[model samples]
Target: MFRYLASASAMALMTNGPVFAQEHDHDHEDVTLYRVFVGDHADAKVTAFDLTEPDRRWTFDTTGQSKLYAVDNGSAVVAVQSNDDAVHFFTSGISLHAHGDHADIEVTEPAAIDQSLTGPRPFHVIDHDGKVVINFDRGGYAEIIDGHELSHGELESTQLKQARAHHGYAAPIGDLWVTSVASDAPVEGDAAPSRVGLQAINADGAPAGDVATCTGIHGEAFSGAFLATGCDEGVLTVSDGSDGPIMKMLEYPDDLPTGESTGTLLGSKSMQVFLGNYGAKGLVVIDPVDEPHFRYVELPFRRVDFVLDAANARFGYVLTEDGSLHQLDLLNAEVTKSAKITEPYSMDGDWNDPRPRLAMAGDEIVMSDPNAGLVRRISSESLEEVGTVEVEGQPYNIAVAGGSGVDHGAEADEHEHEAHDHAHSHDHDSKIYQGYFDDAQIAERQLSDWAGDWQSVYPLLQDGVLDPVMEHKAENGDQSAEEYRAYYEIGYKTDIDRITIEGDAVTFYQAGKPLAAQYASDGFEVLTYAKGNRGVRFIFEKTGGDEAAPRFIQFSDHAIAPQDAGHYHLYWGDDRAALLEEVTNWPTYYPSSLDGAQIVKEMIAH
Candidate 1:
């Protein structure tokens, strides 16, 4: 049956496939299933297609067009959360491909959990082993979905929440389940720990004790035998327990200042986890087996996207907005080399724009470039582009499962939680409000200077002049000033016209103008500028200034470089951001011809 699908796909490729020939033959044992699950832009529904063969041979649909965002195929059932607060589950095991020349795109017809989660929005939908965990602030609970059963359809929903919404995780061991406590405290960037206690679901599948509480790990996962949790101070490593899992904090060296890391991926082959630090784009490999130590490897570009392959622990791939794939060597602990797979994705606008994400299927390092609407399959060993497959919609995530596709029946350990609504009542043109005071000095009021709460992205914080981390004070999203500030708003009219979101980059046209942001080879520099080290800063050259030799205006450092200067935007601290401001303010302190004071006087007199 599978052979027919392959032949039909191959035959169809003869007419539509690229004229290019194979650089190398894919042997049989190398066969791996790489499913590119794409989510719609405005619709919120999801579609899945296979990459090993072209033509996307099959497809899977979601319930009521939820923003079919992330997937956890690890549990055999793929779950999608709707932007409308519906948690939908689908048996990934279906005869999706059907028989080649003809396609079933057989959808096992996704079913909505009878219990609506307290969510119009949910952040993370994770499944560890067979236990599925969902955290929805709108639902006002952290519900644990039972994965042990085949019929994931409403198996069980356990809600855990106290106040509004925040992100949490489920730590699943054989019989014991560790869930985060609910908290109402304001969270900055999905980095804060829950205030709720950690609940232990005993072997009997009952909530054993009261909220088991602590400043829980920012993110949790089972690394080999130890269930690991990330914290601001250090990591809390949980180990096997006769009764349940035990937790311990693994601190970094005192000299390291205990940098916090998130977006952790547990190793499938080793007891290691890959964490990207908020301070910079680097991987801190925590070797849990050995006395824990964070082996850091910094990449030139911020590690925007990453994937783990414990089998090939030697290296991992990072897809940066700069449009390049960095091959970071775990052993040497650095980005050894890089290759360009796509055009540069603009750093100009919105954060959720279609970007590529890297995932590994066995030894193959494949990247799903949603912007290009294609998958760039590279040879994991050679780091060379082997082939590219296009899937419609935005291929945001990819999950590989052992089973091809099936409709498994259902089973036990039912846990249910109260549901909530995650829908926000803000209008589409809602203005974004950043906090008042740039540098605690003045105001930058937008159309909201008078209108107040009924706004969005108001009094914009200009990204070019000042990079500020505005306070976020919103949740369960009531467009209140407090809630609106929790999210920042920036505007950019992008004309990514014809720019293929192919490899790591994109080439597009905006208003008939060509634009690109490829990776810079010359390493960038990190400078600290402000007092609390909280001031935001970056290396930016004014666009429309000069393309030949771009001039750089780094606020963190007092130095000004004209176009033709060669430098990269690496890292910068508050010190760099401030000291540069002080130096630039010299016209009031002391003057120099370089200060442009003389030119200003001449212009005024003229």
Candidate 2:
């Protein structure tokens, strides 16, 4: 079967037809699956669709119009209906598991978990470590639920209560809960209690530290080791300390203009940077660890909305009132690219008015255009319009789940953790594999095992003529056809179109130009994946060859014994250690005897 590429661990069990096989029907393989969830602007409904089959949609009703949040590492989504005082959970039905060398994917139908949480004004939802916290602004308490239990359809929560009801926020930080504080007294006719500062509390609802001064604290985000809360005066940062949670006030720089403070913040998952709004036409990049902490960036126009690329941490996307989507470089603090996306969305209307929202779906950026009643997909690398998904009502908020992972058959068993230790420990050693497999039929082999001429299948995929094969894989596997194509597009790119393996000699052909080398056995490495399955990589080092030839090459074709390879993924580089670290790009090849149509038939039949 076709394979998918991405990252993560499996959270739930889902069984289906035969294990995803290419030639060997019993051997399991990886596949990519991405899900997009959109909440309607005026209707009490949410719509979901896989990136592969956008035409096939799934809909669910809520108590009221809601805002969606992708929590629990994309396994589930939390829909918070503040006005209705209700929260709902739905599993995206896409789970990814990381084997030491690759990831496995499982895709199921998206459905509600049949659970709900109701409180007075359920507002901000925060997910940290393995916990999800829903702060009820009027209830004056935050509900903390284990992310694991949540994916399993449970609604139990440990309430972290405050002194009184207020428009506040709370998040799980290490072993303590960092919660916003309310004032002692409330003015007459006020909607809620006034927020004064922030305080840390234990898991048992007891105080862990004194309240830190943060007048009118609101926005909060986690970046690296720090959790920042936005304040009128500045930004309050909290991190784990040797003794307890440490709080620090990062006041606005002296050079920054007055009357401007961050009220909305977005944090990076890979870097220690925080991107926050600094008034209507400017942005602030907060470096929580270094000096000269606040770096301000001027915008082209008033910003409508902005989102960070969690997968690729160096960039962000900002939608301005000009109906333009601008790519922001977090590392350089500048606008790197821009493209007009929709009709101008003025910021003059009510703050809650429907507008465009941005979300990252794999390598593409998905934006909700409420006015157009469509969800637009933009290429992150090119910032160009690629495609669009139409919706009946205005599409307002969107949250994406699903990634790439291998799907071991229903009968597959969990791999021993010692396999991971073995892979890591033998990084520098020439021989890594040491009888990790229990089957007598699977054993180490010689260089003569897979000696033959091979051709690459990348050109066929690039021409977009393999839809039938993709559709077949989609029918048997859980994901859509387009998803499988996208997966191969990334995993099968290569300059060398042909390869010939004979005895101890290997020849790589680039445009009919051959670079041949003699290789010696360098042992094999066994890797444990997210599911209880494992894969093996046969290693070889160049003994005599042209200088242009790579010093090392590893071949993985779902085989470990002395047998011929029907097809294989090849990783070649000069650095033996770094080549093992590379997982995203694996140039694949098949027998030269197979023609284009035959290859597609082979894939479909497999």
Candidate 3:
């Protein structure tokens, strides 16, 4: 797919005109500006098209065959040359802003190849949190380049080299670097190494320790703070630890029949899991923390490309060669929906043949059809074709950039109108409270803070008193309250994941379930439950500036009456002195059971 070149006449037809004019209309305010940078293998150029307006934004002329890699959340695209030893960066010229209720995107001039790096066989480029790591497999070295610097024509890089040369990958995690290990010995013929290991390099450019063995490790991905590298045996999991980075190997289940090992690994940002390609007709769902981590799903045909829904944690889209899009539910490990969007592009040619590539542009799934020289857009919500944009030559490698955001111009106008209509003001004095109270008196005050570690501590106030039956049931547990509390705290700290904020929605996947929260007020949000009467209300209040002690409160009718009906205080700190201060100085009540109090005391003592 990377071998096509443009003719002289065809190259002359492509224009460098302004893709988007500086016309800021109210209609453009709420609309998401989508840009698809297509690397035409046959044309040897990158074309930028505004999918929102359905127009060609601009075209970048690459001197040779290239492959495009999206970086900085699609704000930029890097075209790595296939015929030479060089890489180029193209700015999508789209800026996204979030204003809670809506979004605004500004489309500017496309910056083509503003900065580039040259090396021997610069092929693999991976974007990790805005840092682009380009691996020169043939040269046995990799360069980590700052994505922001590259966009501004500034070059900042860290060079990492292995002991021997092989086709491998590398990723930077804080001060440490994880890279694929080279083959121990050179093969006599053309056969490649069957197995390889991984090594960690410290910031000082020295090996941290011995290599971790994994048979035939190829692709790598990151979900939350966890990193997964696909291997023949299973998957090598890497996570940041207090000491450094910890590595573990999660093998496939013995009951599952073995096939070809996964070479491409895709991590879901919303969940602590990894999605991998199993051979040519299957998809593997892997959860590093779960027992029997691997779950395979058979496909109808060979997969063309797939992408996880950034806005919907539970949904993923897979475009097969049969010209159909299948929506996958990661929670159930099954395809819940499917739609045919294009003509069948059989997977019967060379691996490098121009086919289709899938990418998510906000709520839309963009698929590039190289054979048709067109890009198809499908709504992720409906799983139906929305629009299509035609490009010059064969549009092979495609990357999308843009999102919804509120327009500041419209917001300013609305505020101006509101000011003229009514003089709205807030009373800051009434919101602030200052006091000291004993634990008993504090319990009578309204609960304010709720952001902290909380669990169901039994003797769950049945009626207005602790239930003896539930209390005894809790006491029969294998682990003591102190032990369980300690263990829970450790796990909670280690599993520090985050949710994605898009418009009014905050979406994330937790405990194999999709969870979402919608913005309500300044310090309040609404959490929607899959099976519940009304969504729970989450109210956050900043009690003190010292250590920023913010309290989280959950209000729901379904909660246990009286005790949980009001605001429920969530305790997070293990400092006994701090806890005592909160109990004595703060006007709040600890509504936990007697055992809960004991657990808190033990945690504080430890």
Alpha-carbon lDDT, every model: 0.41, 0.74, 0.56
How far residue 512's Cα lies from its native spot in candidate 1, in Å, is 81
Please give, for residues 1-606, the per-residue lDDT of candidate 3 as tens digits: 011111111111111100111111222233346677888867768888787776657888886667887665455678888567888887777644211111234457778755577877787777774478888877778888876555444667888876666778888765688888867776877665444888888755478867898878888887755788888887899987766678999877775567777788887654567788888888888888866588887889889888777654567789888889999988788999899988898889887788888887756788888878788888887888888888878888887776543334423322211111112322211001001112232122123222222233221222313233223222532223343333223212312122232444433334434444443322322221111111222332333332322233222221221222211222223242233212101111222322444433322221
Q: In the order shown, what is each candidate's alpha-carbon RMSD?
A: 28.8, 10.7, 17.0
Full-model lDDT, candidate 3: 0.56
RMSD of 2: 10.7
Best by lDDT: 2
Q: What C-alpha lDDT does candidate 1 achieve relative to the native structure?
A: 0.41
**Candidate 2: C-alpha lDDT:** 0.74
Q: On lDDT, who's better, 2 or 3?
A: 2
Model 2 misplacement above 4 A: 1-26, 99-101, 411-606
The deviation in Å at residue 496 for candidate 1 is 64
Error of 1 at 501 (Å): 63
For the record, the alpha-carbon RMSD of candidate 1 to the native fold, in angstroms, is 28.8
TM-score of each: 0.51, 0.67, 0.64
lDDT of 3 at 302: 89
